[model samples]
Target: MNITTLSILQQEYPKLMEDGIIQSNVPLKEHCSFQIGGPAEVFCTPYTQNQLLDLLRFCLNHKTPYFILGKGSNLLISDKGLSGIVISTERFTELTVEQEYITASCGVTLKDLCNYACENGLSGLEFASGIPGSVGGAVFMNAGAYNYEIKDVLHSSVCILPTWESINSLSPILYLKVEEHNFSYRHSVLQDKELIHLSSVFHLKRDNSETIKRRMDEYQQKRQQKQPLELPSAGSVFRRPEGFYTGRLIEDCGLKGFRIGDAAISEKHCGFIVNLGSATAKDVLQLIQHIQEVVYEHYNVKLQTEIRFLGEM
Candidate 1:
């Protein structure tokens, strides 16, 4: 634990208590979908966009390393762990529907967004009903299943500015900086700056509420049948290579049940890497590397991981 970090956080936000923050020695395994990571130097969850901005600004001013984590569903943190701060957006959840659009804060879950749409008799987000991640995370990776993605429905977003403001609260000055951002597939202009995502606006269509609910239920069932939802795993290990599915290629290489330490290529779905009982970050990394090697050797297709690797190796 960095005493300096803790002291500064306390000074800036008196509302946060020592118990509310996690220390470096505590395992980070519980934070990720893979359940395989060491620890973070400091972990904090902010409840509002203002608090998040304050944290970001503090890190920048002090030259401390920091990370913005969401649901941690698509990440592989290293065994050596993080050297600095890790801020979780879990408490920033706020959802609302205005006319034909659904606006959600960065911490809102995809499942929550789908449920909201279903309740409101809106359609077009059924495919994401089973997606496991935060809205900011979903937008960052263009997360999809059943051939639909956030990019397909996103109207716009409220992205924060890194250098434009010293205070945590948003004002007219912050709004001006937000306007300069650009968005695209699995990316946004915010990626270049330390700015964090505040909320996102998704365009949806009004439809029969019953029909939308049915579709959502169907997608959930399909996911339950196809994915190893019962286990701990990063949903998908690799992106689909152009004209080729990563799962099929891995299966073809006869690596479906391949294991490294406690990490195994999910027998339930070859695209996933699951933790059997206790797995390490190295185990997942080795498994991914072997799969990439074997798949490339057999079919000459290089598989790229969909999961982001974090912390020190």
Candidate 2:
């Protein structure tokens, strides 16, 4: 951003500065699972709903671009760096359980949510036990595993609809029921609309604690056995194409173990692209492009990435 805008933010949002909740020129590599990314011009982590609203209002009023960051498990940030502010909801970690329902903030990790459910003898979230992402990120992508998705258990969500009028009026908050979200395979209404997820309520079933634990353990074991868990990766690189399993198709194309720079298609799991130490964002991008080209040439099916790419490529 320009100096004028920066000065305006620093002057107007003094609480953020005083609390050290906002920082300048923060590196993003450490925050994401891939361990790759350049710096963010500005980074802010709001601790409460009011603080979050203030931050959003300031950005909207100033017409400054901002991106919401979750666990960063399914993200690829450009090496050139992001130009505007990055709002991380890591501080919004509140979680509560009441009867068969569990409410979790956007920052709560999927693992933590699953563990909490298991501890409370709630089933349904066992399938997400091994997914590496925050609750908001999962809900944003309608994250799924083993044929179970977030939509299956989602009851409702609290969101901020950053529509043009809402941003101008500073009236962004919205409470949406499950049907309103329009969840589908690797997608949700949030993907298309200018909606920011705040928290989610999941409706589950009462189950034996031991049974929940057993199911969670089984899923984790399966993930470890099948995925390249030992290395740094952004999980599955591509969405499943219709009538074709992504991994099997890549393996059939002999793309497994293929490398560009330090990024490689995982031999253990062909669907994944692993950061084999010192991998750059460029390396991963090139590898992905190469995979798409070769896979299309051989199998005649185009692959779409499941992970989100931020900043300029």
Candidate 3:
């Protein structure tokens, strides 16, 4: 809308921008992964839990569409720019060790968590040593790799209501915790709503710190050698179709290195759609649609998207 309307909303919702909330109309491309997306109408980074809650309430009251941004690793934002508020959880960083459990905020990256766990002599997170997404995004998608997933070790998580100032709770009003969430394969109950992830508790096993470090190092090296880390990509583009592997299917279809504008299906990994320096969101989306059509035409099974598309499609 207009600046006047935004000003009026700010006046009506003082708690949202009391400290003059961080807003940017034209942020640089390098700030986000994928190196794409136009500009955000308003980009807000709430540092505290209270700040996040207040902003959510404000967005809800104003009927302003908002999207939660984490590491920008598993998303494709429209090149036409986002029309509403962009809420960033990058400031929700907090990590603590309690007994054999590791409690980390949603903004904490998987690499950081794995390193922390290794330093503290904890196991069970070695599988996530090279994962690039943040704790919130990983947990939301039940992210997994190398035979383990977030659901395997997640004890519970704390989440805030999407449109309210309160945290998600049960019928008895129990506070949001990891166990309270209903997690499935690559999915969670929080997926249906716009809830903001606060933090998560992971129950890990105590181990030799040096040994944990060695394993993490090994996994990191393996990932660097295999994954197309040099390019901008949203990990896997499509989910496994039924009993079929997405990568194998694409490979079988001879779709490796398929290009659409600057977007190309990663030949290094068939499951990935990489932005080769100057790919637009439109190009990537078109490539995805093309892959879907071809795969469905040949195999009768429809592949699903694991990446989250934000802003306008």
Candidate 4:
């Protein structure tokens, strides 16, 4: 079940901790760009799929709750801390290029992937260059900007599917075709299934490195100008509602720069809620709730959070 406790893991995998793959009482703020989470009771980083599979099996069997941590860009963990083990995919960074295809492991950053593609004279991922997320997180969310999404260039993916019955073969390893992803705006099949993405293949067309770099630089410049890059935030707090821009709505509601303790709506960008030194999860939650209430009352639009919250508020 992987959702009960983690004592057995610590006892059985003592060597893993000694090898630096497992840790205890790890502060999650250090891992995420938001710098707002408390601590994780247990934390693990497995370098290979085999190791990950073994850990997964153990967790599933032992009913120890575990949360996957990828990039940590879009999360708002609890100030009270999380009780379960956190499995970080940061070390799963194997990347390769073969002709028009680029294969990257789960932990590969979008920036590195884009740069690698550019270096190889490949194009199509330039729009993802400035995104602060890992490949797995990006794919899981079908993350996109500038009218391009991961679904556009995704060729295939390797993942693990957990089901009670036979899933084509005895092995859990699956090669998911792009057509089977069921992708939509900011969502992928992974969000609806108990699947773990291991790696992916992206198809890109040939292009001049200079041209690709220029496009990438243009996008990065836009992000720096429009977003609150100087502040600690979990990117945009709300998903853009149809026919309405979230940031604009918040700004129109006179809620920009609103504060709840150390958590405040970014003065530069209304969509973001930034942590202004020693902000707690409680503060962010209160701020988010206030924003939602105020926006709904003013514009009849219920702001839905894009950021994933974990643990107790």
Candidate 5:
């Protein structure tokens, strides 16, 4: 932010500091699974959903730029850093179980959600057990694995819209049903809508905890065997193109294990790009562009990224 904007932020939202919800120059790498990113100019982790809404309202009223961060698994942030408030939902770890249903907050990890479901004897979240992202992000992207998806069991999502763009008259919050999500492969209504996911409800079925655990463990084992889980990296780098497997194509082009700085494709799985210690965001970005170029030239199939990019490069 410029001097004027920084001054305005300090003058207008001194309460953020008092509430212990704000910090300055916080390192982004410390919070993400990739272990890559520069610093955020303003960082906030609201302890409560109400506080998050308040923070959003403050930003909207002032026309301040902001970004909402989840577990930061499927993201590639720039090393040059972000220039606005970064509100992390990492603190929103709330979970509940009622019979055959599970309600999970946006900050809750998929691993935790699956564990809770298993504990409750709820089957159907096993597919998400191995995903590294948080509930909000998963729901936003309709994250799935092993031929199963969040759309299969999601009952509804509680989303909060800013009052300025409110759809409800009495309250800005929305209880969006699963069908309203319009879920498809790696897509959701949340992608097109301006709403913040507060929580989600999953309609699962009763099952033996042992059975659920077995399924979860099986999926986890498969992920560990095929994915580059030992390294610091975002999951899959590219979406599977029609009639083509992304990993096979990259491997065919002989780009597997190719390195650019500390960034390199995983020899184990050509689909993933791993950090070979001290990789910068620029390195990863450059490597990703190179892979896309190579793969597209060879197969005439453009590789679309399954991951999201943030900040300035």
Candidate 6:
């Protein structure tokens, strides 16, 4: 643990400390969907925009390394854990419905957004009904399923860009239109930018409430039937390699049901690597490497992981 860093944060943000905004030695495993990771040095959850900005400023001023965490749906933290601070947007859960659009905070889950859209007789978000991630995470990764993506409905987003100068004079907040995001297959401009996603505006169309519900139900059914939802695993382990489905390739390589410690290639879905019971980050990593090597050796195509890796091994 970095005692000096923790002391500085507590001292600098006394009010936040008093309010229990900052926490020490938080377990990353409990926060993420994978349920596999060590501890984070410090964890902070800011409920409002101003509070989030204040935390960002403090980190900037101290030159401290920090990570912005959402629902932790698509990540693999090392067993040794993260070194610095983790800022969670979990409490930024505000949602509003306009006539033909829905605006949601970064912390709002994709499931909630889909349900809200349906309740309001809005369409276009049904594709994301089953994605177990936050709005910020979906936008950041251009998360998509069944031929639909966040970029298709996202109108704009309010983002906070970090500046190299002093935090006292913080950088201007940007209202980035969807086109400015430079979205592509499973990627967005936010990936390369030093910005914090605050909220997103999605332009949707009014549709029959029953129709929207039906579509959502269909998608949810497909997800349940095809994915290993009963197990604790990151949704997908690898990106779709051009012109080929990653799951098919892995299955063809006869690597289905392959295991390393408790981390096993899901028998139900070759695309996912699930924790049978007591999987470690090291177990998952080794299994991933082995699959990549075998698949590459047989098909001469390298597989790239879709999930982000955080912390050291």
- Pairs with backbone N, CA or C atoms under 3 Å apart (clashes), candidate 5: none
Q: After superposition, how far is residue 179 of candidate 2 from its true place, in Å?
A: 0.7
- For candidate 6, write residues 132-164 as lDDT tens digits: 999999999999999999999999998888765
Q: Give all TM-scores, in the order shown.
A: 0.90, 0.97, 0.92, 0.95, 0.95, 0.98
Q: Positional deviation of 261 in candidate 2, in angstroms?
A: 0.3
Write one digit per residue (lDDT tens) for candidate 2, span 1-313.
Answer: 3466567888998887777788777889888999889988888888887777778888887788999999999999998778778999898898999999999999999999999998999999999989999999999999999999999999999999875567556567889999999999999998989688999999999999999999999999999999999999999999999999999999999888999999999999999999999999999999999999999999899999999899888
> How close to the true structure is residue 302 of candidate 1, measured as C-alpha lDDT?
89
User: How big is the RMSD of model 4?
Assistant: 2.5
Give the Å error, residue 301, model 5. 0.8
Candidate 6 Cα errors over 4 Å, as ranges: none
Model 3: per-residue lDDT, tens digit, 1-313?
3365357557876766676665758552544667888887777888877777666666776777778888888888888788677778787779999989999999999989999998898999998878888998888888898878898899987776664434222221224556556777788877876567778899999999999998888888888887788998888888766789898898788999999999999988888998888999999999999999998898887989988787677
Clashing pairs in 1: none
What are the per-residue Cα lDDT tens digits for candidate 4 across 1-313? 2223455775776666566787778899998888988888888899977677767776676666778889999999998678767899999999999999999999999999999999999999999999899999999999999999999999999988854342323698888999988999889899899578899999999999999999999999999999999988899989999999899999999988889999999988899999989898899999999999999999999889999999988
Native-referenced Cα lDDT, model 6: 0.91
Q: What 10-residue stretch in candidate 5 is worst by lDDT?
A: 161-170
Q: Model 4, which residues run further than 4 Å from truth?
A: 1-7, 163-170
**What is the C-alpha RMSD, rounded to one decimal, of candidate 1?**
2.8
Candidate 4 vs. true structure, TM-score: 0.95
List CA RMSD, all candidates: 2.8, 1.3, 2.7, 2.5, 1.8, 1.1
Better of 1 and 5 by lDDT: 5
Q: How would you order the candidates by TM-score, starting with the best?
A: 6, 2, 5, 4, 3, 1
**Least well predicted 10-residue stretch by lDDT in candidate 1:** 172-181
| Clash number by candidate, in order | 0, 0, 4, 5, 0, 0
